[model samples]
Target: MKSTQLTSTVHLDYGLDTLFGRITKSAECQVGLEQVEHDPTRFALRVQPPIPQDLEQAKTVLVKVDGRRLNGIIRHTERLEDQSLKLEVEPE
Candidate 1:
């Protein structure tokens, strides 16, 4: 499998609403996507500003990228000095 290094504007869907019991908060930001190893469902995400502080490990989040909505869980997170957030996400 071939891996693509892509950086684009993506939507991050997180948090829950009491009324919907589903995703309620969304933020538009630039993100870098690189496939992890040979797995298409796993990715290393380098998220740029505006960086979100709510994202954490084991949190389920939806990322809308290039017209595809990817539902995945954050496996790990790292805070960069540049204020960008690095994340390892695995699609569930």
Candidate 2:
């Protein structure tokens, strides 16, 4: 699908399992949003640091951006050489 790139700040909420128990972590970061022309519910997001590890395996990602709340499932993930994480997400 064709995509248009845009920039925005977002809050990512995810759960992490620690030695104690599962904990929720919230990260605020700048992200590049690639909106898919054919499918508005599917897009690619690129984010930098303060993000959780093993994010692709996360059950669900709660994204708050552009005054909209989205629950996304990570379809794929790639770690760029610049240390940024690229993820293909499908909103549910």
Candidate 3:
């Protein structure tokens, strides 16, 4: 599939050992906010493949939404047949 421009970018840590750990990178596919729940500050994020490697294993993620940087943890990850990923996060 053709790559589309990402609306928002997320920076994920691979681990303390990986090269990407020191310098996080943006996701490869477009990112869209699906939903945001008020209680505990949880939300859903949609991303297309190729998904970032670190993202899959990341326990936490850093993202900018509406000009605000949010630090969140991955609650869940759902894989779609079309090679898209749905991520559920809870802000910390």
Best candidate according to TM-score? 1
**lDDT of residue 54 for candidate 2:** 60
RMSD score of candidate 3 (Å): 6.1
Residues 1-92, candidate 3: write the lDDT tens digits: 12224575454332223655543445444576666544446776667667876666666667664555756777788887887777778877
Per-model RMSD to reference = 4.1, 3.6, 6.1
Q: State candidate 3's TM-score.
A: 0.62
Candidate 1: residue 15 lDDT (0-100)? 56
TM-score, candidate number 1: 0.66
lDDT of 3 at 64: 67
Error of 1 at 71 (Å): 1.4
Q: Evaluate residue 54 in candidate 3 and report its C-alpha lDDT on the 0 to 100 scale.
A: 62
- Candidate 1 residue-wise lDDT, 1-92, digit = tens: 33345556677776543554655567787876666765656876777777765654326667766566777777777788988777778888
lDDT of 2 by residue, 1-92 (tens): 54334345577886545678766667777776667556677887777765565664554567765566766677777788888787777887
How many times do residue backbones clash in model 3?
0
